[model samples]
Target: MSRRLFSCFGKASSNPNHDDKATTTADLTTEEQRRCGPVVVELFSSQGCATSSEAELLFSRLGRGDFKLDVPLILLAYHVDYWDYMGWKDPFGSSQWTVRQKAYVEALNLDTMFTPQIVVQGRAQCMGNETEEILSCVASAPRVPAPTFQATFQKPTPESLQVSFTGALRTKVDQEGVSVMVALYECGLVTNCPNGVNKDKVLANDYVVRRLEKICSVKDISAKKTLSGTVNFPLWESFNPAKCGIAVFVENSSRQIFGSQNFQLPDNI
Candidate 1:
């Protein structure tokens, strides 16, 4: 089995159950990017897993320096709960995330599931927290050739905010089964690890996945074309209003990332 999602860019298979599905995102105007902020790094992690703990620590330390550069990289940590059965339950784990991870495993044929996985630009994946490996991955990572996409949060009503994106598809990059996914997240989360494998450790999680809207394709991602769209964020009853934010990424059938960005829900949003 190939550990790849789509051999082509944004051209997912029509078969929904065939492990590859094509997607079309809603349309938007071209002016949205200027209002949206920086590039985001989404980390799939877990506290019950010791490996993720180290990755989280190392990433946190890196944020202090690597992010000081002009390109400004944002780090978001999502805690996967599948490992909760191993003597300690990760209070932050969501069944939805477990399902998401399983889908990636099935699509990519990972053979086994593991924590501390990092998806960069929805184009590649690597074991997280490994300084040497991560450095190499970044140094050799391909440039995101697609048109730039940007998003911002707008307060629509008291209970919901609108997430809008702007960009163009200069050309179809993925010949395989790559698609884009938009998500909402919460930032600056701290948990007390009283009983998990990370017991006695205080963990700070960033970019925690909150709501996933849909899989998308660049509207007109051709060389000089441009497009945009919006996703409404309904208030979830269980979510912490204070910690909620948003994350967006372009991913392939294998769950590798192509491009991604995230933002915090405005104080008023």
Candidate 2:
């Protein structure tokens, strides 16, 4: 249901039983000077949506390399809070994610926002559960050199974790209002839904966004662009470094992503 149930309207695949249909072929390559990075696939989902389980499952497969994709993928799932009022209060849900999704809604010129939506490189979108369409979007998205960054982790306090990163852009980049967005994500999560649309269900989620921070602003990322910044994340109960990781990407004013990279958090952190 829409946050404003009466006024908000959106489109979704009427066919939830998405099949393993073949997808449109794509060939993406770059000059040797600057090779392309992995595709950044962002899924807007909620644990409260009954229909989101399928999409979540598919995302797990994509993250775990269950599919033989030509290009690599850096997957992230943002759980929005609008569905909370329906019954189940999703522990992962947040209004910040809702704002982020709305930004995509405006950028894509969509009628409204919808759950189980996949935005590829911030350029193309499709129903999240539609396997073929999702792969097609990934295949066709424009490519760019992967963003490069080095994460430095500091000793953590009981309540929060602080980390810093230094990055460089070695190739031609032509985007304004560029920002570095860092996300702390988790995998292999299982939740027992006790209320609402997903009542009495055991749901699994991966690449779930636990924290998102736009760490720095760079007016011009072309040429030898260099930047460094730090972000602090509040710790959650039962947090395990082994299950968490970081994803870094570059995005422009239009919210179109150019490249992304993922780094695993050290177990000793």
Candidate 3:
């Protein structure tokens, strides 16, 4: 029995042309299905904001094999550009994401906007700076039937890598206003504080939202939708393996998060 899921739209304001429906890729043999997995956790943050630093710290602490299951918490740090005028332009900031945040504000019916907002499961939002709240949210979170998402990371030479993911819809969903988003993040970013809030304190950040790319939308899921895309990373700077991983998730017909996951590829093929 096939159920219909209404399509949802993204909160971003630029209104980038999106498919909003299912897409197709080369046929995947049965073997391809074995390695896919869990939902994702997204954090909307900014580099120049002090509050966001706290949240980044929390994510760093949690990603340290502290959770019950070895299940790594998949995270995508969406660098927002609204706070750039405050001084210190975030190398990773994107104005388009700021537009998306506005849409979320309207959707959540909030009084105002702020930094360090954590979007969990695409249905809920919490302040990233609150450790207790984040812990509670993750502990009691609902379990979703694992979806099929395959990602491949390749380093053709050195100092550069390419990551790709293909997400398949598990249940039939009404493709009315939803969009499929493929987000990219960097791990193990350390900075010698100079001008920001934590001056002189060398801060470490993991699960950082370095970049965001909206691949398509739920409107494309009309019995023929598949989520797939790729993002490239440059390794010119120093990074840590323990603190690095790739994350991806899907938003529903109303721009609410529906699913997500994080992955750190194994070293030996």
In terms of TM-score, the best-performing candidate is 2
State the C-alpha lDDT per candidate: 0.58, 0.78, 0.58
User: Which of 2 and 3 is ahead in lDDT?
Assistant: 2
Model 2, residue 95: C-alpha shift (Å): 0.5
**Tens-digit lDDT track of model 1 for 143-241:** 333336666667677677677777753336544644666777765668888876777888877666667776355332444555577788776666665
The candidate that wins on lDDT is 2
How does residue 46 of candidate 3 score in lDDT?
A: 71
- Model 3 agreement with the true structure over 130-197: per-residue lDDT tens digits: 76666655543433434467888787657766777786756455635455565555677777756555
| Model 1 misplacement above 4 A | 1-41, 66-74, 106-109, 122-124, 150-152, 171-178, 218-221, 236-245, 262-267
Alpha-carbon shift of residue 216 in model 2 (angstroms): 0.5
Q: In candidate 2, which residue pairs get closer than 3 Å at backbone N, Cα or C atoms, i.e. clash?
A: none
Count residue pairs with overlapping backbones in model 2. Answer: 0
